[model samples]
Target: MEFKLEEFTLGPSIDTLKKCKKADLVVIAESFDVDVPVNINKQGLMELLIDKLTEKGLFKEPAPAVEAELGALAGTPAPLQALPTQTGMSAEELKLTLRIREVEVRNRELEVEAMHLRLKAIEMERGAAVAASPSATQSPSQSPHDSFDVSRHIALVPPFRESEVDSYFNAFERIAATLKWPKNVWSLLLQCKLVGKAQEVCTSLSIEDSLKYDVIKATVLRAYQLVPEAYRQKFRKCEKTATQTYGEFAREKGALFDKWCQACKVETFDGLRELLLMEEFKNQLPDKIVIYLNEQKVVTIADAAVLADEFTLTHVSVFSSPVRREPVSTDRRVRSPNGARRNVTASASARETRECFYCHEQGHLIGACPTLKRKGQIKQTKTPAPINLIQIQPLSDKSTKVVESKKAQIDSVFRPFISDGSCSIVGNEKSVPITILRDTGAMQSLIRGSVLPFSAQSYCGTDVLVWGVKMSVIRAPLHLVQIRSQFVSGEFQIAVRPELP
Candidate 1:
């Protein structure tokens, strides 16, 4: 179709180009001599084509409506002949031209709308600027130095504490920043919230010093003894309170430690701060845990704390109660002389029939035997079995003679047969089955030294009296054991008696 140069110069709108497929857009860009890459997508090709066309002056500024201009030119006289000749276009070219004109008109309308939006934004910004200006809010006669009523805002500040001067100041600074309170008046505002010793310190300051917030703060902190040494002490002694969560306690401890470092001016040096923290942390731990951390050669406070926590967890688990065991049967089975098994109610019938070993009496155990008490008062003439002697060496010949004489006297006293039971001692690697004697007269449990494993380290020395003879014994640490169908765990004294069967 034939077209005027003016028609071709007016390029297609972005919307029209967007409606075309990637291949069609590429073809159009090639016609306009735009350098569009072969791999470019439809939208990218369209943008490149429009930019190239505009740079080359192919897209002209849109004129007034083409339909009105054409109608005005086409008079009633020879209108049909003048329309094609004057425009120099066919029906199809005229339709294409009219479509291009329509697109340009729409683009102009969008540009005008955007301009109006930009103007609105600028006006809104100016309004906001005016609203925020102090001059706009205040009357001409009002001075800029007028005092803000901070007393009304005193509720926003947390109450000052004599013990927590640092914490109170931190909270007050944050509240002041939020309220936009002048720095010069911060001391005045803070004074309203002070009480007790804090208020006294503020009042004692000179008027000039009181007006200076930093001066007032320093004086108050000094009065409360919140110095570097105080912070160090607080950090060292910090303990988790019952009501505080673990996270909260950890944060509080960290804050105190930071304060100590800052006050001492060692915060810039990590090595010094870490050393101080590690020492303080070690002091709070048990001696054993501290030793373990030292053995691990921990370099940082965090690593030491982690190791200590792991050790604590493992230690606690060792003492914690084992899973709930099913109730054990109190009933016992007795093998009669005829080789027949007979069920015995050990908890009821057996207890009623049982006799005390000391008195050979029913309804009571040897612990409460009346005859046993009399035996302690009335010396027995019967010779007792040779007692196991775990004696400590006497310092002198006279003391040695006295110990021998005491042993001879104890040999004459009557000794009673004690009840015994069998149980296994569980260790990290293996279990050792050992027989345990239940001495009703003795106040503590005792075991043979031979029964304990060589690896066992818990040894507490004490003198135990068996019958009338006093013997030295080593107390072993707590151990878990399987006693019949149930687990038993506790500490036991180790008596070094190889002579006993």
Candidate 2:
């Protein structure tokens, strides 16, 4: 179905205008007698004709592509594709298909770019969080060259002692290098703070502004110089037991020897192994075991330590078996064959006749006697004397007068601060008397729940000090109430530890 160039004088219908291609639009423009650019592109020509046809009220805008697809699917030919001939229709269809595919590819590219950006944002957030964490920040905060404070750093470093002087000097030398202090002042500073006998050699110099670091160091070291015999004597004297582990004993002996070497300026490893081995064998094991090792000639402390541990475990097992053994009663009420009970009291009496040599008492041997321990404890001076609340124990009738006089003397000379008080506790039903001690050195307050008439399980080996003597106490929870007076009170919580003494 073809049409002539001069088919209609007025512009074509809206449907015909919508269906016309750029070539058809250019032909229509020429037919309408309107001036068109000689070099105008197809798209420009199409737009110009659409404007001219719309100005003349002969055409309307085409429907969207989606509506066009729906219209085509419903068996109606779209307005934009209503041309009779199909010569350039395939090219237009190909261009529209390529444009839609290009749009889909562009959307996919945008989505991938957005995903990458989101992942980067998440990584950046995690990095920031890790940097903000305490563990991650700790190392950076500890950069010595940046935040070093000499007095503060040295304050944490303990005081120099003879035993640890070598390590101390080595560490301080590094710190001095970092601080950029003069090398000449190093030994002089150390000499001034000398811990042991090293100071004795540098005493009373009387020289001002002329003492050299090397000279001071040499003099102190000379004083520390000792012979191999001295080292042997000191090392051999050291001992360890099953109660003390090999590590602890080694540390103690090492410190002692180090101190000795520092004082003598004498570092000798001679006979050291023999001394340590012998000491370990003698002290860690029993006498019989020590003799056996001496016969075998054990040379290493490690071997001796192992043998000693085995011996200790064996002895413990042997001793513990007796407790598990059933006690056999020596009762003399056994029935004889003639139906008469024969008394075995004489045999029991003869067995009980053994006496303790230490206490000279009957009915017990020296090994099983309890009196020897009491005697030794009485002689020991390490035990702290109990502080007496009252000086004298008077008769009942005269006790009041003596107490009054003692109280007067106490009030006048030695006034004691009483810690016990009665206060109402929060979350409790009644006011109770509590012993409150003011320990200025303590980090937290404690209370005894046993004083509250409640069940508080004991935590054994929980040590505390009472009147300067170390004692064990039990832990519990305490609801504290501070009473300023009879009318005013304040409630608070505190950790409770029972039986302060």
Each candidate's lDDT (Cα)?
Answer: 0.58, 0.51
Worst lDDT window (10 residues) for model 1? Answer: 75-84
Q: Pick by TM-score: which candidate is best?
A: 1
Residues 146-205, model 2: lDDT tens digits? 333434444433366776544565676677678675565555455556766766666744
TM-score of each: 0.28, 0.22
Question: Model 1, residue 160: what's the lDDT?
Answer: 74
